[model samples]
Target: MTITYQINTPLTAKQAADIFISSGIKRPVEDLARIGRMLEHADILVTAWDGDQPVGLARAITDYAYCCYLSDLAVCREYQQQGIGKKLIATLQEHLGEESMLLLLAAPSAIDYYPQIGFEKLTSAFLIPRSK
Candidate 1:
């Protein structure tokens, strides 16, 4: 299987919104407008394609100096276990270089996976508003 990998920020809001919805990543359609704006501020957005089809996506929001958060990582279910996610993350790290903090919120099932990718468990506190 020949897959193409690219590091680009030209991804459109429609493309991202569609991927998020299709991948069941829990991003609501109502957020697409916000997401579109957010994408503009991203340091990098890497995508994997199978000859024109977007099969995976990984994005980072950063200051490009101090820290970067690896957000919106997803690979279509059928495309999992083929190293797509790893490739995406590795590419992002390359762009980050050294001296930058890479952070992410690991999905419950993926906690163990993050550690394997060089992320140690961090003890930090954050607040989320309760659902109304």
Candidate 2:
């Protein structure tokens, strides 16, 4: 499959939700408005496309100078293990400044995957649980 990557591409909430569901990412896909807001507020968004279909996505909130929080990374199940996720991350990194540090909270299923892609495993991170 010939995959094409795009940065800051316009994506409808439905398209985002579809990939979330297909990728097995635990997102509120039923809530289109919330999904739209997520897209609206992200400072950076990278997507992997197969022709007209979006097969993967990465969204981040960053200062583009100091730090970048990689808020979401998802690859459709059918596209998983094909390096689409890695390419999406690489595409995002290309947009970041040399001084920027990338960070992300991995889903339980993805804990091992990130390290394989060069993300350091950290024990010092903390989080306040979100109330849905």
Candidate 3:
């Protein structure tokens, strides 16, 4: 499959919502508004499209200088393992260039995947809500 990348400026709220949910990245519904805000005001967002439909999204917040946090990355389930995710990350890395620090908090299942995409292990602090 051919993968094409597009830089979106303030992507529709619905697309952002789908990426928040379908990519298996958990976030509260209340956060959708914040995602919209980020879409409106942060670094460029790279989206992969198959025909006219959006199949993948990679969102980042970057200064294009010292640091870039790759916060949300997701591709449709039917589209995994096809190098779409890797291509998205590669595209983001190219945008960030060589000197910037690229970082993300990987989901437990995704720990192995990130390293393969050029991310190294790093110790960081995090907090999660306790299950009732």
Highest TM-score scorer: 2
TM-score of each model, in listed order: 0.84, 0.98, 0.83
Ranking by TM-score: 2, 1, 3
lDDT values for all models: 0.80, 0.95, 0.78
lDDT of 2 by residue, 29-93 (tens): 99999999999999999999999999999999999889999999998999999999999998899
Candidate 3, residue 8: CA error in Å? 2.9
lDDT of 1 by residue, 17-116 (tens): 7777766676555677777876787778899888888888898888888899887898877888888888998888888888788888876778787777
Q: How many pairs of residues collide in each model?
A: 0, 0, 0
RMSD over all Cα atoms, model 3: 3.1
Point out the higher-scoring one by TM-score: 1 or 3: 1
Tens-digit lDDT track of model 3 for 47-71: 8888766788888888888999887
